[model samples]
Target: MQLLGPAQENLTPRGMKARGALAVMGTSVNMQIGRPRLQDLLFSERDQEQGAASIRQLLREIRIALGPHRDAVVTGPGWVGLDGQIVALDMAGRAGADGRRPEFAADLDIADPEFEDWLRDARSHYEDQADDQLAAGIADDGTPALILQAPMSGDLQAAVTAAMILQEAASRVGDVLPLHVVHGDPGIGKISLGIELGALANRSGNDIVILFAARLRSDGRLLWSRRFVLPAEDSAAHLRRVAGGVTVAILHGVEALREVVTDPRLRRMPLQDVFSYSAVRLRRADEQLAQIDPNGDRAVILALRSYIRHTMLLERLAKNPQEEEEMASDMAARARELSPGNPTALGVNAMVAAWKGQSETAFDMARHAIAIDDENPIARLAYSSALTGMGHHREAEAEASAAHMSALSELGPAAWVLRRAIAATRIGDLRSAERYFATTHGYAPENRPALRFLSAIRYELGDEQGAQAALQKLKKLEPDFTLELMASDAYPVDSLRRAGLLKITRSGLI
Candidate 1:
């Protein structure tokens, strides 16, 4: 199972094929594979008789490699399997001490197309397995823990309602934020924070007030306390409305705690550091994260690095696009490897993939991320970008709208609105495109691309003065951007052409 060392170069064609066959079987179901399948994978270039003969010869070579443990390769009537009881695969060794999974069969240079196909799939399979193992090995490493205190009253209905409210609020806050909410008693060692909920009746007794209080568990320092009044006969809709207000308060409290808390685990400074627009800050954040967790097994940290690289590419901060793309790709791949069930990591991976122009990969990753967390604005934005790239303009617009609506921050909505505007233009909805572009510009007035598209859309819509104003703003931000540059094959020329701006410019409309 471990076939990636320097000695692999000494492997003869037969020895290489033998190791390849073992790799195929090892990654298959129950460590077993059908003989016909193995032959097809390893010797598809040969005729049936030649392929069967090659499989037999390869098996014999494997037996010789095994020596005294030759019987570990158990051959049935039409299938080959490894005896799990006798031959234990050291998956950890295959993963390496540093936890990076080496390329499967890296030394095998078989010319058969079928074998190459199988090798690619086998590599992906083992890579996921290695990622899971490595992720499991990573400790919590001082992650802050939140414990929900039980209600003092014996009224189960009130407790359930209060818990539902807290849960709904937390969902609104989303997992993209670095906050861990755990439901447990104080006995759970060193709980960083504690939340308690209680219900009180209004003086008129026609309404109930739900009190939410959070405090530091370490020294019982009060952090946040608020009360939400609900109707005595509150409906599900009403409760959700209350939860929305509560979500804002909770976020504000969390931000305040992050600002004052000195504990690295409580503050989550690395994650906070990544939100800045400066490349220097992002690089420093990445270095600090690596120092905090040297193993590089934290999927979120890797995903953040990928996000940083992609952001650098977008902001024109990266001096070399090719190098930034490679770094983003590597960080995304590693993050996806270590993140089995995490939607944020998957969303970041999807965003990076879309930025790299791997439309199909971006579509799949974004879909999986959305399936895991439909409300994730990043995932939705990524999906919209992929759809737009594939010319599914209407679908892209819908997803982009959803992303914009659900986005918590101005940046998220700005990106989503820009995509929506682009998709609208592709679909020939000029008015909607203009509106979306204006919204994007409003969110980030310094956004040069939004300004460019907004100007183009207004001009196409015959709003010459409006277009001129937008163009003036764009010129202020990017002096090189002009009607001549827009007509040329420079950045976003295709987009301008799609908006009919290039044609208008050629018509002497300025």
Candidate 2:
């Protein structure tokens, strides 16, 4: 994954709007910052207006811009939440107690000692309320008043306050540059939140530019495509050149940009930090894959097959959302078609099928994959999972053993360990199941199956607290999950395994 950078003067604005903002010195300015996506600019100012004419124009322009993808574009602003609920912020500032626009007393000074205390109290109140609602798995209709920065306007009071804090710092000490560092676990929408904060700063009359490192060309221009290319120089050089303005650079994968933090020149740059973790899931599989191969270029498929397989493993852990499945299917098909008879692609197919409960299809594909590459660890794991799901515990155990014997020094796939645990559980070897479940959890701590099986095994072994701890993680990861959800699925359909699951359910493992 690469960082995405800002587009310089490559294309003309398809359109422009005159935005008015009050300047810091009490004067008015007519100016606007460029949005990363050109299309978002079309409707960026709608919330501040009160006429149907603008909305109608937005629709007409969208029709022209989308040409072939209009239906998907015209869909409402709502997004699917982690719980599969349609969620959209109330952008009109027209609902709930928190909907009221935040205000500061006219006499308050930025240097006042009480200012920090007041800001902390206010932020804590809002954040705690949002946290409570999330923890309780509250329905969308019943959720507490929350403060999410509007995607269009980026006018959340918190974001505004954050910008003010930066401005104060910049003024207090010369060259105390305002660099905000927003970091989070993989799929928690860090980029969007950072952009929103950047938008707030721009609207506050700061010359802020948002860019993605992944899009930066060798000549320091941003390429307006999904393709990623390594920069000719470190991204910090590009940032230093834009020293006159505030810059919000989106780093798609933090690891890929380690130089920014490790290199002496960049490491010394002053930065305000923001980190968030949902304690739920990894980043979205599509976003992750896009970072890996955003443009779908055909030439590097085989060269990147290992990375693709690693992403595929993440897809399985993420429950294989439709977009992920479609992307995986297309990539898997290409991997196979481009390199026919390759064991890796066949193994990937079998794994995908196994996740979708296509047991027989998975079994057949795994057999074919293994026949072509018996020593391939992925094929061995796929065969093991398929065999377990098909009620061949003995055969599955043998396959898992083979995979273990040939496994790399690094931990093998969690799915492989999971299959072994399932076989052990089925064969009434609870001790062995417990050990493998522990290994599975070590390999993929957030994996639901590993957590679930570990919980059940702990309960059976009389480690009630350990079981409860695992269950709590499950609760946080999948709030609506119940023990009944584990009943005799195609993945583990043996009568013995079904009984074991039923007993675990009765034991209140959920």
Candidate that scores best on lDDT: 1
lDDT of 2 by residue, 1-510 (tens): 011112111111132221110001011011112222212323343343432345345445533543443332222232100111211121111112222223222222333233345435634654555433323322122111111222222434323333343332222111111123322111111121111121222233332323212211111122121211112234233332221122222212222232322322222111111001112212332333234344554322321332243343442432555666566666766766765575656777777777667899989988998897565545677788788778888888877865665422122356567767877887778899889888877776666666777777788788888888887887776676666655545333343356455456676644
CA shift of 499, model 1, Å: 4.2
Error of 2 at 31 (Å): 59
- Which 10-residue span in candidate 2 carries the lowest summed lDDT? 19-28
What tens digits encode model 1's per-residue C-alpha lDDT throughout 116-165? Answer: 88778867876766534433311155434445544333344555667677
Which residue pairs show collisions in model 2?
A: 3-213, 3-214, 4-212, 4-213, 4-214, 5-211, 5-212, 5-213, 6-211, 187-283
Error of 2 at 381 (Å): 1.6
TM-score of each: 0.59, 0.40
Q: Model 1: how far is 404 from its true place, Å?
A: 3.3
Task: List per-prediction Cα lDDT, in the order shown.
Answer: 0.65, 0.42
User: How many clashes does each candidate structure show, in the order listed?
Assistant: 0, 10
